[model samples]
Target: MIDGLSFSLLTPPLIAFTVTLILTGWLIKNNVLKVLDHPNPRSLHTRAVRRTGGLGMMLGVAISWASIPAALPISVSLGVALLVLVSFADDIFGLPVLGRLLMHGAVAIWFSVALLSEARGWMVATIITISVVWMINLYNFMDGSDGLAGGMTLIGFTCYGLTALLAGNESFAVINFCIAAAAAAFLIFNFYPARIFMGDAGAIPLGFLAASLGMIGWTKGLWPPWLPVLVFSPFIADASVTLAKRCLSGEKFWQAHRAHYYQRMVRSGLGHRNTALLGYILMVSAGVSAMWAAHEDIAVQLGVGIVWGGIYLSMMIVSERYLERCPGD
Candidate 1:
């Protein structure tokens, strides 16, 4: 009785949203995991809060995936599972940074080489593998602020779902929509004055999915490879630039710090709520533009990239000037 992209197709995301909302609320109320993120020199928040929101969000995603008939590639599914297990371990018992990086590299290589090498060749796959590893770490780097990662996940995955739908890939759309929906629910508790954090367990897997799913969509002709880059340009830009700056200054890039543009914005009196709002604006604009340019010719897509590149450059300059003028107000 329903029309195209009807109830059946939409049910999975709704289930995902509901499950995450209920589960996240329960975890917060009961202090289920007792994983507390306390304030630290590098932290943005001043008080301790639960960091088990990732557990609820991922459980929601897993349950929703179980109900859907569409199956992700076995390599991707296994890679995500491994990340969740290891990241959750890192969350509870402090794992060595070297060990975590090795695991991330192994998973990235597994996903990229095992699945992508035949289609894109080993050289291209190697580059993608490195990008996947960067995405994993960059996501964790950007998860310091309230609502930042959650908002990015919701907007970024929704863009992926929309592009897949436009490409007539209903199953793929459902998968992405499920991710966005779960992120949306997670945002309820993660917004300014956060009740919980997604921790490494959530950020790591979400980052992997962002890169791997985007690659899958590209290989399947759902969208161009660059579209994913454009959709997530906000995160990629900030993290990449910050890392480069640190490395050039002879600072250890791997150590946690509050030097990200967003972190500085918050510390410079922008506050978490406004900083997150600005981030959401950037994310939504990038996502919408990527979706619009998905089916256009090469020139239009290139224009989109150039325009965003300029915007990011200008924003970074403005942030730098502001920091110099304010000087830790």
Candidate 2:
């Protein structure tokens, strides 16, 4: 048998990955629970498929996080739990937009006040609070395509976890790593021609954690605030650009549509597997550059960002032209 301390260090990620596998298997096998996501104008999937994979992913994280007090504080876990419940309801009953956003905002407020109690200024606290809400929503928005969200979660958290470890923040590292592990396990079922979808339940809570843990890392001086931005730049760039376009065009941003860049690419004839792999390439590039920049001076960090920014710009333009030539709608 393994020694206690050593075993404990390995427990969170191991248990999360294993449980995710088991839950995914069960979810796929139990046809009664299959929340077949019917096809729509915005949907990439043509047929109904299970949408309960979020339960698998969230269950793994929830069970493992509760047991690892050293890695994830109870307050953070509570915030995740609240979002998961609200999102789960949204998945089942088609929650009203305003109500869902309000609950998300409430959770953001709780996080900002409880965690940043000694925040220097109310303005700072308010801004962080709003950012948290955006993080939660944007992630849910970006979960439209097969493999996109799971790949981002796996790559982004793995990068964050590794960087935190390098900075001597083992607690942050372990939590991040375990999340990444769970995401990886979930990806097996969520990949191209996905057997299941993550739904709002998984996307929302994961988004909140992405922001919350990034902030925690920053506060602890474990990593720079922009580090998370870099690690998740692909999703951030895609979601931010898509939101801006919708605002400029005066569209109802909350309404589901296939306007997102990743969605466009898939609808534009680039298959799901190809678009997902391209996303993976971008993710790895951003993550590797972020890790490298962590060791360099401020100027080098900016240069790294600029390089990635240019790449993102190129992708956006390419996607646009491709869609213009072969419009999906």
In terms of lDDT, the best-performing candidate is 1
Q: Give me the displacement of residue 242 in model 1, in angstroms.
A: 0.2
Q: lDDT by residue for model 2 over 118-138, one digit each (tens)?
A: 456678779889889888889
Top candidate (TM-score) = 1
lDDT of 1 by residue, 1-329 (tens): 87765875778898999999999999899955888988987888999999988888888998888878889988788888899999999999989999999999999988888766445688888888898999999998899999999999999999999999989999999999999999999999999989999999999999999999999899888998898899999999999999999999888888888878988889888899999999999999999999999878999999988999999999989888987644321
Off by over 4 Å in 1: 1-4, 325-329
State each model's C-alpha RMSD to the native.
1.6, 1.9
Q: Backbone clashes in each candidate structure, one number apiece?
A: 0, 0
lDDT accuracy of residue 42 in candidate 1: 80
